[model samples]
Target chain A: MISSIFPSKNFFCLNKLSVCSDSFHLNTSLFYNEYSVILTFLFIATILSVIIILFSYILAVQNPETEKLSTYECGFEPYEDARHTFDVKFYLVAILFIVFDIETMFLIPWTNVLGQLDLVGFWSMIDFMFELSIGYVYIYCIGALDIH
Target chain B: MIVLIICIVLKILVVVVPLLISVAYFTIAERKIMGIIQRRKGPNVIGFLGLLQPLADGLKLFVKETIFPSNSNIIIFLIAPMLTFILSLIGWAVLPLSKQIVLSDLNIGVLYLFATSSLSVYGIIMAGWSSNSKYPFLGALRSAAQMISYEVSIGFIIINVCICAGSFNLSFIVLAQNNVWFVVPLLPMFFIFCVSMLAETNRHPFDLPEAEAELVSGYNVEYSAMTFALFFLGEYANMLLMSAFVSILFLGGWLPLVNLFPFNYLPGSLWFSLKLVLGVIFFIVTRATLPRYRYDQLMYIGWKSFLPLSLGYLLLSVGILISFNWLPT
Candidate 1:
């Protein structure tokens, strides 16, 4: 079954995961080779979890009662439905996280190339951080992240 | 082709089996250590020192009744724990047991870990929303906000580590610490990283999601039997994963302590295990030691404190490296 799909062309060295170091003048193929093992890991993990969950589904005793299955909120009879309008602060925090998180993402490539780039690169990243701090300052003063 | 498939399966089993076993033992280890700290015996009767307790617990969960909330969205509810467990397992793929023994030393090993940990936000969100219960819903909300907040700081710390290493590869990150581990020079970042790791795993001082006093066991409040067990397993697995991450980034993954005669003689894999064990003990000790943080204080620490501290540290190190020409090639 597996043989037909993989057509045996120098299978991943049975000994080691393909080294995709930055030093390797990386082509796209080498990158794919590095990722092949992860696909296997994911497949095996999904299958294993499914089988385990299904096993419990099958072998487990079935004894569902009325109140036992009801949504629990401190054993009271219950109030209205679970969903209700709550604080908008969580939403605000999440929105701000997205903006700052993207700025964090931009720093990754900047950091990776830092050693190779000259003093200009360092100053450029410093400038970027300065702008980000300004945004942070604005958010702080506006009380966007304040709980009170 | 069959051989290749077999090899991959064997590789997965090698890492996964031991990992699952350790996660199992780690539960007992946690109980035993916490017991000693609090002055009592923990789980000693189950097996030779509670060694067989996890296996027994697994069997018990397998045969127990799984309760489905009548008011829940059944599909997403069922999928949540599965997602959590799967996310935890997949992160192990890129962790280098030793330099030669990683399952996948992907170029983006650091980001792969980060991304998977980030995706775990969904499992909690799904479980909370789908359970259709008030407590779980509240738990989920708290969890999402908390996770997203800490992750920002963690991302900065990781960026600093990656910059220091000059590569995102986990192996390269480990090897970069050959002369002096990051913990020594990057000491403050190391501390912040540890604190964030605790928050990231949703453990002590920051376990706001599962805060029993208010949230009533939190998102898994309504979950029972094997479904509940999946959440438990996933959480422990994540702790193990975070501990391993700390070792790789700061303590020097698979590096023996002090390259002198006695320490250098030990194999790299053994050194890695020792460091990983130390990390797990750190988790347990912190759990035993600290009380939970106030939710508002938690948010304050994540944003106002760790974020700027890490950001400043990032620029400080970057400036130092560039000025001194100390950057790794």
Candidate 2:
């Protein structure tokens, strides 16, 4: 019964676990082999990027005047060098933005696998999050992220 | 095929979910650690010690206006973070947390990891170039240089591991260390690996690219809200990957210090998790303790210090193996 379910190849030995006896030979013969997966992803990414570029170009209205091309931050005339000495506040905000933003991305996958993980995964995540919160609070207290 | 699909799904479920949650909290952990180190109280508001802060922050970003600079190449700007985020996530596919638990237990797992990590630089460069901002561009350039520089040493270190273990498979590497962790025999290589990890992940003392005082927000300066968040996620995820790599490579991943009662019965994945958590704590501690290094200082440490040390260690390991008749005689 187990053999019927799992087939001839043993799960423990991954090299022999594939459906075909000569899996490597089959893999070599296939046009899109396992090795090509990364390349395929790269190719897809490139194609998507090109498509986005073309789409943006078609939609964008380019009035390429000097001032228009220049940096515009809340319509302030390019006052001070772009490399002007800015307060650490700007950086703090940027760091905070990055830090918390990453935390949110994790919630989705965690929620999905919560059932299988049981309390172990849950407590681990909580502990992990708690440590992260400490960093946030530290940064906040140090005025790392404070704009004021 | 059905079984294969089930295995693949299981791998994804195991790797991706934990990865995301870990990345999220890594940020919070960084902040909190930095807070404690500086002798200040970290986030205590927003749901009992700022427990709900990450959620609230995510919501705020989701609703925030995404501003595109007029001169920026908007498409690349948008895609760059996504690229970084995706690439970061892919490395976990090859990382074997335990005996039977990995997303894609490829034969060339180490090579796959190296390849993906190298590819991540493209995202950083694209983010910088597309922003059309000098700071972002400079940051991107710095990142490109730094990543390439350290990557060589990192690759060499991994090669040394491969030589010692005689396998490219991560699980095999972990299994090879069953008798003794690599940290004992390959102490120098282990040290180099740790430092290389710091450089590879662009953590403090080596984070020249994102040096706030100099490069502003680095490559993603123009990025706002969730887009910015993606880069953030990618960075933290990369950090987690590095930490996990360190744990598995040197710390005898999932191998308890002493096989006590519950520890003996505990799942291998649990041990892997414990090691990972400890690794994350180390990351936080480093961030808390170390100040950012100067750009030249960062480069000096990588090239002058880590590179030579790792190469020397590799030679030492080779010599030891040869002397012991451990080489395929």
Candidate 3:
């Protein structure tokens, strides 16, 4: 699957070289070739961040007083803890978002096969959308869309 | 294997170094533009016209104390910024700077971008949750809700682009725009997309979660020094990423503005970068000009307005494309 996407001529040489060396090596490079740049990016980012973290550890002054480390709520003293009950409105909104987000995700595959799916594709999406609209209306009617 | 690893590392450096420098300089650009807009000198004391301000700022932050709240979850708190920074950088792997220049060039390039962006929300959430503080927690909740709200609309807009372009590949999306950028025909989408992009990046006007008055700097309020710097770099990098997205998806990635005069002579990356800068400038101008939205107002715009608008436009474009058989192969 990976090879199918990165079918560049360079892959051929990389593949041959890996095959000649070791099977385990070939597997990694095969995955690497398809996404090596992205992986390398992640690696570099992690390294860069680690360096900064270490740099700060060395240079940054640490004066850990009780007041300074305390949770900031204006300049007040002890109150209820920060981890109190969250508003349920956030949960309701998140659920609503997930439903539509999944529906939107469907559009990607649908659009990819659009021409091949043709009229059937079009109507199926319409039906899919119709159902989705019903869900939207249900949420709206329930005032889930309303800011609490 | 060794050579292959070396080559990959070199390529990563090539993309990242310039990106880091730009992220550094963009801080200056934002300050300068905001200064001009506000009739104030932003920061000219650090270097000639404050040319070295980002360096100075970075050094200052590097040397500042990192405050770890005694009550905070130590590991996750530290990891959150790193996650954000990494997620932002990884998106560039699929972006094409020019026809000849790209890092990975995945078949599902746009999807890769979408995935990375969606994942970035986690960083904010982690920062908020792990902080073990109320303000940061509230900020994180708001950010997560906001991102999800806008992402749905953004996904629909992207699907519309895919429907028109007929492929998920970013280069193909750009190539389809060669004759005419998508902004010309799909003007409403461009508007919705740009607005959603603002929300997506938590920029001004839509920066509800980070409203200083209410949230005291949102999810990263507890962060300081290098940890804070990582988050800062991540946000700016995401801004650049969104700018690149706009240029690629709507402005014709590396295409010359016009086929005539000086436009055609400039290199493709230059053209790409110019459009990107224009997008960044638009963000800056909006920041300078508009007041931040109330949290409720931001939600209303994302769901009630942009969501339906983009969804309708997606359906409309699909109907027109199929009827005219204009769907790309």
- Highest-scoring model, TM-score: 1
TM-score of each: 0.93, 0.72, 0.93
Docking class of 1: acceptable
Residue lDDT tens for model 2, A80-115:
444434445334434443454354334323322333
- Angstrom error of the Cα, residue B5, model 2: value is 4.5
Instruction: Name the best candidate (by lDDT).
Output: 1
lDDT of 2 by residue, B74-146 (tens): 7887788878887887777667777776545566677678778888989998988787777787787777766
Question: Fraction of true inter-chain Cα contacts (below 8 Å) kept per model?
Answer: 0.75, 0.05, 0.66
Interface RMSD of 3: 3.4
Question: What local lDDT score does residue A9 receive in model 2, on the 0 to 100 scale?
Answer: 42
Residues B134-250, model 3: lDDT tens digits: 999999998899899999999998999888887888887898897999998889999888998899999999888898888889999899899999999999999999999999999
**What alpha-carbon RMSD in Å does predicted model 1 have with respect to the real structure?**
6.4
User: lDDT tens string, model 3, A1-148?
Assistant: 3333223233222212424555566556546665767777788888988898888988777888998887777788747778888988888779989889999877777776666554655787888887888877787687777785
TM-score of the second chain, each candidate in turn, equals 0.99, 0.94, 0.99
lDDT (C-alpha) at residue A83 in model 1: 79
The second chain of candidate 1 has a TM-score of 0.99
Error (Å) of candidate 1 at residue B223 is: 0.8
